[model samples]
Target: MYDGAIIMESLRVGTSLEAFPLILRRLSRYAVKTASADQPPVWTEFVFEVADEHAVELADALAEVLDQPGWYADFHNDEENFVIYPGRVFRYRRGDQLARAEAQEHGRTLGVPEPQLDWTD
Candidate 1:
């Protein structure tokens, strides 16, 4: 079985809250939550489990939202990670970060290395 998650980060600036319901409606299949407890209630995080087949759909929905001004979102699975920002979505594999600036310019996901688990050593 494959597992994945989608995490969206939106600033608390102007009318950003207005996009919440639209996003929830679009991604109704996934579980949703706010980051109020962990954050200062200024940010919200929606999380949900997804199968391998649903990854594309999740990315598309996130891409739509990210296309709008002032919104940022991301999706990650065992295979890859995506960063969605205004007007574009960046795609890259976990632990990869070649051409980050170029990716950002082309509206593509940058390659960022996954955080190493120091405890594993």
Candidate 2:
């Protein structure tokens, strides 16, 4: 069974400090795997999972909520992941090392400094 699972690894949300609560509220419905917060700089990391079908909807929602100069989101799933800062998307298979390497190479070609080329559990 495929399970239609979408694991979001290292989902970094860059937004105004004031908007974090709202973003958290909006994503509360999903199953959060890990969440981290750092003071002084106020950076956060949210790792969550949702049905594969809902990935795009979630992305759109986040993009809308974090729409600002320094606001961006990075997501990693079985198919592809986005580096919003550079506006790049790379595709890779869940367990295929070769595909992941290729995707990373492709990302480099597109100017992504450090592409995530590993599978997320």
Best by lDDT: 1
lDDT per residue (tens digit) for residues 7-89 in model 2: 12323345322322222212223432222221112223444444566555555545444422233354555555543322433
Clashes by residue pair, model 2: none
Query: CA lDDT of each candidate?
Result: 0.42, 0.39
* Least well predicted 10-residue stretch by lDDT in candidate 1: 112-121
lDDT of candidate 2 vs native? 0.39
For all predicted structures, in order, the TM-scores are 0.47, 0.37
Tell me the spans in candidate 1 whose CA falls farther than 4 Å from its real position. 1-41, 67-70, 99-121
RMSD in angstroms, candidate 2?
8.9
Which one wins on TM-score?
1
Candidate 1, residue 119: lDDT: 8
Q: In model 2, which range of ten residues has the least summed lDDT? A: 1-10
